[model samples]
Target: MNEQSLNLDSQKVDETFFTVKLPEQVGLSDQLWHLSKLYTLGIALSYTYVHTPFKCPRSYNVGYFETVIEKSKSILNKFTSINSSSTDKLIEFIGLDKHELNISDQQFELCNIVEINIDEILKDDKINSTSDLKKCIEYFGLYSKEKIYSFVTKGIYKFESKIEQIVRSANLDDSTIKKLKLPEKYWKAKEKFSGKFSIDNSKVKITLHIRKGDRTCINLNGKLVSVFASSIKVIDSTDYRDELKQSLMDTTKAYNLIQEIFNKYGEEYFSVQVLSDGYQRTFFTIIWAMVRGKIKLNLNDLKQLHKTKKALSKEFNDFLRFSNISLVVGESKQNLFQSIHAIVCADILIITSGGFAYWVHNFFRKSNQPSLIINLNSCDNKVVNKISKFL
Candidate 1:
């Protein structure tokens, strides 16, 4: 009648004493001398036969899970339960269906349970559901739910830390951080955003008909639609003015230096190699550079471009270390697993220096010379090549 009588004890007695083990135990302690001999086998058989699925139910009383299911039902119950049907439904409001929301990640967590089974009427003493709970106490060194709950809550508090790292590493503005409701502890905005412009869709026309204020996106007929705010950074006329001035200075300086070096070497060491990222400006600069100099680099022209076909790859990375360049860019576009925007900006700037080292093969092909050149960060660190014509 009591709780213990119903579940384990009764069932266990039925199998251990009344059935398989009992027959083996029947007639053995001497008259049934074999009974003692077989006692070990009987216990093993009893355990296997009676206690097959060693499930440790969380509670002896099913009420605990009953309560859980009730709670789940309360929140999820359809028209069949307490909440009545409504024209304005949550599923409709959220634009989703009941089957779609498995929002709970509970299944991903470790199972924390007590004994395998518990009936409400069967007290903990009767069914001893506390065995698994006792295991939890030993494992966690905390017997009370309140203690375990506090420890777990502390662990979850770390969730706040990760948000700050995301914010800082993203280089987000304070206002953006505030808007995201992120705490500052975890976000790390270590990366910078480098910027560069490129001519997209090279075949796209830029005819004289394309007025400064014209909608370039238009077809020949001009239906006056598909107006996209052109993302191309249109260089102002002033860009050429500055470039021309620099070109004059940089070109003259570099030419004079090259001339001096050439006069000393006299076609023996006098070699030149033109490097470009396939940009028209770089090509133009190279052409103008040759014109400015009375000297002509005969026998070769060195032109190498990456297979990527992009004017500049996303950014430069430590790969330049092998080439002896230290390039740092502010671009955080992770399209590149290695380099960033900082590398590109640095490269472009370095063209002011004597330009990149002449790669040996490139030198041999372009000019009859043996030079080791790598575009490590040559463009960003030096204006020598970029502005040799002006100087």
Candidate 2:
């Protein structure tokens, strides 16, 4: 749309254009990571990248889906372009007949369509490391040049050990990181909360993510109070419920270990904030049960004016009245970015096992302040190994 702002090189008259077509079932975080990969590859190969906006069903913020895509394109527009032309137009521009186009081909020579199959690549035992994966991509001539070295460098590796690099490099000054900034309201929330707590340099400020929503209700744990059970798909399996309950208990044990670690540091005091979708009763129940009254609830006054129902139970109300834990309830709603903002602000983060958590961890891998992160699902030996250093 803004040609000059796109920063396209005028000297390069002839350019290769490519579009990244992600799988239909991809989540929002995975979608962004794949786009980041495409952006990196485009820069390395001097290819013009086209973005095709995809649907995200799990997203709570309806506007955020479009906002991120547009913001990312504007920030990283050197190779990014919108889908302004039709498939017929693209075929015509490539000088290929519609009938001759083989949809099953791995790579369309004229119009490059990168079909990302991450699961397939990860299955290979030989491709265990990022270096190995990079070589494989190069070997397949995905973005290989005669003399140009591998664009997926060690710089990205230092930030995250994962194979998929979320950015072009680990340099935070780059536009890749800048593109991740959410709307102004989310930032304001962060700024407002940042001043309320006195974050100790010696102590760790931990933020644990306990994901409870329609999607994770069955797989992770059954809701303590099924307020929206009618909306959720009911799976009729006692074994499934048992497995999920066990997993949740394991996570609860991890939380207890974290509490003990803080206790050993000197005091058992630590700031706990629960970022939930809305005023979900299960979130309150889980936190009250696990945290044992070491928590603060900061409710937005403006948004609080709109909520009609008081979702708290009589027991929770009684606990709040006598306990030292703070409770400030209001009508304000929650969004996905707000949760992410909380993650970014935390010094120690314990997240659920899912794509969303992994994406947030990777995005802020090389944070300004050091953080101790534990994935509840994978925190047996791995988390215990990291715990000795902090203790």
Candidate 3:
């Protein structure tokens, strides 16, 4: 890892060349954002190195699957770094035509997969700052801290070649990547609508983005207070049962919002898009759907029910039903770009406004789309009224 001359502290880390240390475990989207942030910081300093994404955490195990993207291979190579010589090599290396049913065998055959040396990375004092690329600037002794701060705050991040390469390199099907790279016509509201399902180009697409993987009341409290009050007010926020109860209530309201849209648009006039972690909500939706005779329960759902706790899932399901979800997109950290593309395409987004939701909101803001943020801890009818206008 230390073979590169630029890795030394005395030499001053290259201002134009910065290396990212991928986390052993991190949401893929978060990792991409960090990469983009570092790359943007480097561009401000005029770095010339090809912004290459490291094929890291070589064997990331999430849920029930894993894969290894070759190191130094550009995900966006096909889209951005157009070199006739490298294109043939990357295609041959990726082996897009090869299919293997044995996952273990494929992982074993991965030739370049190697663990990163965290010790070398941590020992370098010049690489210590995670903010404003301070460690990099200090190591190189290039710009003042003030200058770096300004770039960090004001730098514009567009869907440029660097990011395109990374997204192209993600562990996604070639078809999806190709579709994403297609002209804007493929993603426009009218062009992307489904006609057979009765979806029309004129319908407003509403995406209900649900995420609660690592949420806590403390975070929600701060967000709600900031949006609704002038100052922070102390309330008994540590009621675990109440927290779960409020989640159920908020979910019901979310379902009601979908129903309201359906009523207004006659189901054919509007479309519902769902982006969820899928554990809690999926469990509840399945149970409710079975009750309403909309869908029959299957063995796999039964297994998940046993795993997620049948009692709580049953209670939550009692009030919520999956009426007309046009599309339900699962959030897989491995396919961050696909999730991002879907989120960006939505006409209206409904989210919780923190954690992953906060990140999505920023993306939407960058693209100039409107969203409704629900603070579940203290969500009120007023928020619902505001959302109704959008419907």
lDDT tens digits by residue: candidate 2, 1-391: 5887455654333444444444323445655465455445434444444334343433432233444564564456436422222232211211221222133333332343333344455557675544555555545555632212212221222233333342223322234423333222233334534553433444445556655442233232222212231132224455466645653464345446555555555433445443433234334332343345342223432133123223222212322322222222221223454455456556667776456655655554444456677777666655645644643
Q: What is the lDDT of residue 318 in candidate 2?
A: 27
Candidate 3: minimum summed lDDT over ten consecutive residues — where? Answer: 222-231
Report lDDT per candidate. 0.23, 0.41, 0.39
Candidate 3 vs. true structure, TM-score: 0.44
By descending TM-score, how would the candidates be arranged?
A: 2, 3, 1
Alpha-carbon error at 390 in model 1, in Å?
Answer: 26
RMSD of 1: 30.7
List model 1 lDDT by residue over 1-391, tens digit each: 8897688765643431200111211111111111111222223222211111011111111233443564565356333411122211211211111111121223212322212111221223332222332343234423423111101111112222332333334343223312211111111112121122221221111100001111121111211111112122222243344433432243234334434433443423222322222222222323343456622323223222222114233322222322222222221112111221122212121122221111111111212212222232222324334333221
> Which pairs in model 2 have colliding backbones?
303-332, 304-331, 304-332
Give lDDT: candidate 1, residue 150: 8
lDDT of 3 at 362: 47
TM-scores of the models, in the order given: 0.16, 0.45, 0.44
- Model number with the top TM-score: 2
Residue 239: error of model 1 in Å?
Answer: 8.4
RMSD to the true structure for each prediction, in A, is 30.7, 14.7, 15.2
Q: Flag the better candidate by TM-score, 2 or 3.
A: 2
